[model samples]
Target: MNGGDPPFAQRIAQVSESHTTRIFTRAQQMRARGRDIISLAVGEPDFDTPAPILHATARALADGRTRYGPVAGEPGLRERLAAGFEGFSADRILVTNGAKQALFSLFQVLCDSGDEVILPRPCWVSFTEQIQLAGARPVLVDTDAGFQLDPDRIAKAVTPRTRAILINSPNNPTGAVYGADALAAVAAIAAEQRVWLIADEAYHVFTYGDRPHVPVLGLSPAPDGVITVRSFSKQFNMTGFRIGYVAAAPSVIQALTRLQSHTTGNVCTFAQYGALAALEMDPALIDRRRVALRRRRDLALGLARALFTCAGAQGAFYIFADVSAHLRAGQSSADLALRLLDAAGVAVVPGEAFHGPGHIRISYGCDSATLGRAFARIKEGIKEGL
Candidate 1:
């Protein structure tokens, strides 16, 4: 070892860089270089935060709401979150910096070395990485054609060392929403196996078609060991604010709260007030965003289906398209993504990062004009074999 080098944790060295963030960084560099890059890589809405929420934050600032507060978040926000969770009590909710932090804390508190956490493939890239950070191995089960979680596959993956299963409905990369029947089946397997079921419902507010977002806690004969994670980032376009919450059994909530207290303390005071106002304000604001997202999703899916093989994008703001048809015989997803960026100036994330190689995730959160330009560039690139 070099004398000048400080020793770092073995775990930190082993952790992989986030694929999504890496691509985002490249896009930023391209923009700096004056490239006409139409970035469809990151999952973020292009719209400004709702006006009412903005106004509320201003009011909070005027009222001197800036100070260190409860480690579990402001009481008013927790109360509103508790009410939102059907019949759950306020004590069961613990707010954190974001759903990402809440998830990291949950894994830290629950997972131990050599334990296994089951995650469905084509998942959010962070899922596997976070479990690894907690010293737990991620057991990935491949989904069916539309990226729907197959309960039978989950059952097969479970072993005596399995500690928990992480499920993300209205999922990140695939935008696949598990049906009620599928969720119920998963709950049954978790109960029979006696493993924790952690559900990520970040995109609960954005859905298309007639199906509603079903929280696993609401399942009949509810799975006794269920934990739900919710976020204000997607719902209220509060991504920069980094505010989210976890709802679970009081025991699990306490463990997560303690872990967060030592790690991030509480989220920013002003952000907490902003989220509270989002919940208390007119529901119509959220409804409008939902409708707009649905329109964008439909358009993107239409384009994807005409150009590539894609499905399971009935929710969220992303479309995971199978680009194997476009890839040359020996080419990989990373190769194809770079080529697309260079030749077409369109930025997309390779599905390889999400354990779904031969595909790429495209976000439709941008305005119609930007999406149109991106698709056109992609179309030309594919035609020219670029």
Candidate 2:
């Protein structure tokens, strides 16, 4: 407090401002000033919410399906979500506002004060923050050169206080998908150590190449303590609907449900209908969308590689480029990111936000024309010593 009174909860102070939202807000302010900026920093898919989902939600509202519903999620939506994961049924699914909430709840359910959660480096920024929010320490393990998991490193990080090992396949920023062997190795370690294997499959639908996205729970010698989280945001372009679900052991699901009852309560009751519609969507839409993302990935990667030696991205819609050579004196990745946003009218994320300095993240969720223009500006900016 300003005077000699108590201040806000010190716990919240432990949370850092989200650098991605900070950059996003700045880009928005610049746009309000009439700048024709091309934003390559946003994480959401650029596609509008699909028609079937929108129609289903509209029908839901029209049919008066809008009261408070079950805290664990409506049975229909939970049943549909549960069907996708092996060994899970409706009783084992707890739908939350988004995958983000599901993750936060998982940490709360599993972690205690001073407990540790091992997260791979250059992982999603929220994972660390959420672990802290649950009064736990996050032990970050650096990945191998390709941004893939180093199971050996993760294995070494475990201690008696370790509560979970969190992995995001097709990892954010770097876009490297961990193969089946890598996942199985990690699961084995979790099982042997009796630690929870937290699998984030938010980008499961966006994996590229012949190797498909594998759910860690399905791998051989499956751990009884696996917790898998997925969302409708990326796959169905339902960002605003705020619907996602978690599949875990029935006991874990019950704990999440009880915690959620006193916490966020049920996700918007009618929004569940939209999620229901998404599960039944034509499989081809996903295929076509992935093909389009592959094209953008190729286009953006080619441009980024010309200036910096960036390897090909395997999945997700981001290209992480090492820009160490382009930095002026004393400039961190965040500095270069803001500099380009100001000078080139283009927006990209700084790698330091992802615990990676000397690198920048470019989201290619926009159309080809926007990507072409943004890259052209970037090239010109580099030529001008920006």
TM-score of each: 0.97, 0.97
Taking the tens digit of each residue's C-alpha lDDT, what string does model 2 give over 1-386? 56787877988999988889999999999999999889999988788888999999999999999999999999999998888876678998999999999999999989999999999988787888999999999999998777888899999999999999998977788888888888899999999899999999899999878467888988837556898889999888988899888888899999999999999898998889988998998999989999999999888888889987675278988888999999999989899999899999999999988888899999999999999999999999999998
Model 2 earns a TM-score of: 0.97
User: Which residue pairs come into collision in candidate 1?
Assistant: none
Taken over the whole model, the C-alpha lDDT of each candidate is: 0.88, 0.89
Please give the distance, in angstroms, between residue 342's alpha carbon in candidate 1 and its true position after superposition.
1.2
lDDT of 1 by residue, 88-176 (tens): 77898999889999899889998999899999988998888899899999999998997888999999999999999989999889989
271: Cα error in model 2, Å: 0.8
Candidate 2 clash pair list = none
- How many pairs of residues in model 2 come into backbone collision? 0
Q: Pick the candidate with the highest lDDT.
A: 2
